[model samples]
Target chain A: MATAATSDIKWWAGGRSPFNMEYGKLMMWYFLMSDAFTFGAFLISYGTIRFSQNYWPDPNHVFNAFPFAGHANLPLAFVSLMTFILIISSVTMVLAVHAGHHMDRKGVIKWMIWTIVGGIAFLSCQAWEWTHLITGHHPVLIDGVVQEIGTTVSRNPWGPDVTGMMHDGMQVTKTGPVAFGGYFFGITGFHGFHVLSGVVINIIMLIMTLNGTFDRRGHYQMIEKAGLYWHFVDLVWVFVFLCFYLI
Target chain B: MQHSSNTHSPEVTFHHAPGDSASTIKKIVRTTVILSVITLIELALGFGIYMLHKNPDPSHALILFIKGVIVILSLLKAFYIVGVFMHLGDEVKNMIMTIVVPLMLFIWFIAAFLWDGNAWRNLRNTDAGHRPAKQEQVTKPVDAKKPGGIE
Candidate 1:
């Protein structure tokens, strides 16, 4: 299938033969790949800190959902719902891109709108979680005495008792050097910023869709590109959830 | 060719416009459900582990093995989400490897660090055979005449 021709012979202009993609889009993917590695580094550090510690608290206990009045310990319920919302949004986005492929402007707009809504909902849930954490919703007693109350600081179990004797559960907390919190806030906060930005980006794309930008061009490539970015954001959250909430 | 280019230029033309395809919809839903079930199972295991044995000796081989399994299963779930839902499955083999390999290596590096750090913590906390140096100096025999003495 190597049909040699003048266009195929071009160095910079022709991408179909060698890369099967335009330089611009390919570069975006490349950047995403690298960024993914950076996020992976942060998550790995978190894992190491958790593992190195003796009695690290369970993520479910640390991140219980807050309903109307008192807080409830649903662990992954809110996050799981948020995960599905993002996934559904990704589906709609892909469909929108597909519609764009067929020059179906209305379909693109509709799906893009749905995708935007889902992104907003995700951001909203995250914002709520962050607010709750910052507000010191959960309380735990430190050691067998001092009561240290905060979102990040807790007397949650991370190690066994000093003696071989066991109580209700391992009562030690504060794993590693206690600097893990700084890393946790910085990494997860940066990732959350990306999710927030993604929501804004999708909103802008939705506006463009409504204005018939893609309709006139008869291509859905831009939508596909945005979908790629959105999916990556979701993928990062998958690891974040595991790092912050589970492992 | 120029005329055809203009017709689609500065805009994209749809060859097979996007819409809700039932097959794809079904696939996505199926994947989500499956992922959810796997996560639920993980939660169940976590709870079960917590209930059965909260303080098994930190150096127990079985406990470490179970923890390893949990971590591996979690990574597997994460991989499925990225590969299937994120379209990495459709990417070139090299590109896929490029994304996955570094991630694995970095996690391993972190795991090593955590293992050493935890061991250090355990050593520092353990008070093995330390007759308290001056235990008798600090301990005073309870006097029945004292106001707060246990009767």
Candidate 2:
């Protein structure tokens, strides 16, 4: 049975797959749907906490530093780079999938390499950002004492300046809500972990292509499946970027 | 592969169409450009919000409006990513529904949680929202040593 009875036969009969798609692809879609819920819960909770708080720290103030730009504030520059890298990677993955459909082994290899490279580049940028935030200390006024604090899960030193205080020619503020750091690291870290795994999966796909696995199977549907997964990672980042960086 | 009246059963032979290479490439390029442009607009809007914050007296309503626009643009980006890049649009109607229908829960999920969160804040402000407070701690004794409750 094929699509010949496209309108004649019953689709929900389930004798064969009624989705008219491969079972593997359907399973991947289901998995991505579940993963979406996971991220949705995290972001929604962050929103809830934010609404509950009387005051929240502005993201631009906290994420104002750039790499090697000492004392110069440049908010959203690095993350914008990260976003572009991921989008480019997604485009390359699409190319890989397209080439896979043609069964052009060389084309698939070339694009897959570029896609993996983009993934690593994004990850490297994220690593630098995490290191910078974790290690960069700023002066904060705590209980009438000047203390240096870096952003962590338990501390946020980006609160409003109540007194006319100065340290290193910068206004020293009190600690803001502690949940800020926790959610920032937690969600972004989880997303980074997904990117890492996606890279690994792409690597495996690359090796399989080089080893003639798909050629032997006489189909490149596996690449299509992996492409779905790759694009899904990109999809999640859209929301992540909006929640963390934009609003 | 024809869509005439006498079509196959779409079971084991329902492979996706691989159109002319040129058209396929063109479609890919178009989607890529669209995705990039949307991202650039989103970045511009993000900068807009930052500029608003820099103003001495930022208009909260305007900021909210810009945020709403950004979110709508993000949804547009997401649609391109999922529908074109992931080829979800090429899937069967039932398949797309299967994927999208479950996602509707997020609307309720977000609404309920944020509603409860805001309600919790109101409750705490009104002394747990149950009964009047005792005379003991209605107004705290102002601390002479610590102003603005630092730390």
Candidate 3:
């Protein structure tokens, strides 16, 4: 016969947390799970469209611009920076959670600020990339004639790079798959929204910590829950980076 | 499981070694290094694909293989993030499974959607009435007279 401490603990006793988890943390985990599906649907639909197309734009060929490099090609460089920012932010968040575990209020505030800065940095980079794509003058050969067009959801300047025409030393390509821009902007934009909300959440948590909310409660469980959401945002970025920038 | 000092408090925290901040920091540092190294390798693979595209006749299979490798590496990075950074690994087994099992549906989701997309591609390519001349599957109409501008 199992003892009351081990296998005999009544899971449905209604008083104890049967899973040995805080209900708040459990709900946060569930919320993240559902968010995962949202991103999953976006990425999968992107893949579906990509598979149906005979010619798709190579991300490297499209995303090879640096901020101040003046048309110098740097494939995967900017997005790599974005990825590191997110990863490092996730680390700081973990540290914040760790510090919260010890009730180290100063440490939590410090790390939370850094994480917020990182989130803003990522958003700024996204803004620049989006601006570059939308307003940036890209020449493409729509039909048999060359046309100056920037990438839009309905039009992608990069088609099959067959006609080796050059305008001002820049390669003029064909109209690539229109859906490419749609999926790229749609998924990344959605993820950016998540990051935006995450930053907001972290700020609120930071304020609560400053006011000693956890101190009054005697546990930093709120920070822990927020950390899960922050890390989930970073997690989704890993895939978004994969789907849009890398492959 | 009931070994924690606080009995009335329902929050179940994993055991932390008292006065062991250094060791915990060390673990965080190690995981950070692991994550960075994996990302670097992924970027290297991405560059390799880019370099291959420069070739006049790049092997398609090789590119696909590299892409496959990148996806797997992404999954590995995801694992470390959720496990170490998010602290999911420290949670109980059934708790982990609850978060994980629903995700398995993605396998079927990706497979089915991609399968149908490929089928659509095939239908357009092989169907006589709908097929564009040769392999030029221009689903969008070519409005040549409409000047190039943002839609």
10 residues in a row with least lDDT, candidate 2 chain A: A1-10
TM-score of each: 0.70, 0.90, 0.90
The interface RMSD for candidate 3 is 3.8
- Worst lDDT window (10 residues) for model 1 chain B? B10-19
User: In model 3 chain A, where is the ten-residue run with the lowest total lDDT?
Assistant: A1-10
lDDT by residue for model 3 (A1-247), tens: 1123446656657766666688888999999999999999999999998888788888998898889988888999999999999999999999999898777999999999999999999999999999999878777876778778888899888787656578877788878889988888988999999999999999999999999988888778899899999999999999998888888
Model 1 Cα shift for residue A185 (angstroms): 2.8
Model 3 lDDT tens row, B1-151: 4433323255443333323689889999999999999999999999999999999899999999999999999999999999988888866678899999999999999999999889877776777637568776668766776788335
State the weakest 10-residue window (summed lDDT) of model 2 chain B. Answer: B1-10
Off by over 4 Å in 3: A1-8, B1-8, B11-19, B128-151
**Residue-by-residue lDDT tens digits, candidate 1, B9-62:** 322111111225676667666877777776676666555444445465444565
User: Can you rank all candidates by DockQ, best first?
Assistant: 3, 2, 1
